[model samples]
Target: MASRLVAAAASSSSSSASPLARLISRRRLAGGADPHGPAKVNLWQDPMSPSKWKEEHFVLASLSMWGVVMYGGFKIFAGGKKENKNEAVPTQV
Candidate 1:
């Protein structure tokens, strides 16, 4: 009984939406403002850019450095990759 009522309500609401409204709603971004303009781009997404650092730059650099350090620490504590034991090929006669 309750399931029938919920199904009827959902069908009515969905049918009331115009085709254009449904398209617009379906195409909208999940959590951001309306998708009407070009996507935002960082002028200095490249870390090697000559542009001076902003607060975000510092945060990005720190995070990247921390990742490198953490990886190094893991390698040190967990043991690194084993070296190959295969014989080398001759390059010259």
Candidate 2:
């Protein structure tokens, strides 16, 4: 039992010399990321996993999406001012 513990510690110490292990060690030694800052979490990751979504979440999303759709519709019908100027502007004669 004591031998197994010693062997495990030896193996771990050996692994600490690995390239991947060294990168992890440097990050830890540098104190890693700002713990209090907002995270740039991946989109594929479940956003609700760490925090539960309340009514505010749905309300905020609904308002934002509503604004987006409204702006899109306005852009579609307004025939925007820059279209003629940007469209394949003809070069000199």
Candidate 3:
């Protein structure tokens, strides 16, 4: 009975899984998609028709404006706190 118990324990532990199973599972999850698929269609484009360059250009311009606004806000808030020592010096003294 003791030998049977020992054998069962050893079998269970050995059956646990090799590293290859884990590696394969990870690869299968990560490797399926193409990294360079075509860009997504804009809302203005019909699903069946190819997207026009003008529509893409409009979208890019809007995104660029949004980025500029965000950066301008950050710069304003960041630079607003700093006092210019040269401006603070009294020239009339």
Best of the candidates, TM-score? 2
RMSD of every prediction: 13.1, 16.1, 14.2
Q: Write the per-residue lDDT of candidate 1 for residues 40-79, one digit (tens) a residue.
A: 3353664465254555666787798899999999999988
Model 3 lDDT, residue 74, Cα: 96
Q: On residues 1-93, what C-alpha lDDT tens digit does candidate 2 reach at each position?
A: 565456555667665566444333223346555566554444335555434334456567668889999999999999777745557878898
Candidate 1, superposed: residue stretches over 4 Å from native = 1-52, 82-93
- Give candidate 1's whole-model lDDT: 0.64
- Write one digit per residue (lDDT tens) for candidate 3, span 5-91: 565555555657664442332343565586566666654564444453356666776798899999999999888567657656667
Better of 1 and 3 by TM-score: 1
TM-score of 3: 0.30
Question: Which is superior by lDDT, 2 or 3?
Answer: 3
**The best candidate in terms of lDDT:** 1
Candidate 1, pairs of clashing residues:
none
Task: Find the 10 residues in a row with the least total lDDT in model 2.
Answer: 19-28
Kindly report which residue pairs in candidate 3 clash with one another. Answer: none
What TM-scores do the predictions have? 0.32, 0.34, 0.30
Task: Assess each prediction's global lDDT (C-alpha) against the native.
Answer: 0.64, 0.59, 0.61
Superposed Cα deviation of residue 75, candidate 1 (Å)? 0.4
Query: What RMSD value applies to candidate 1?
Result: 13.1
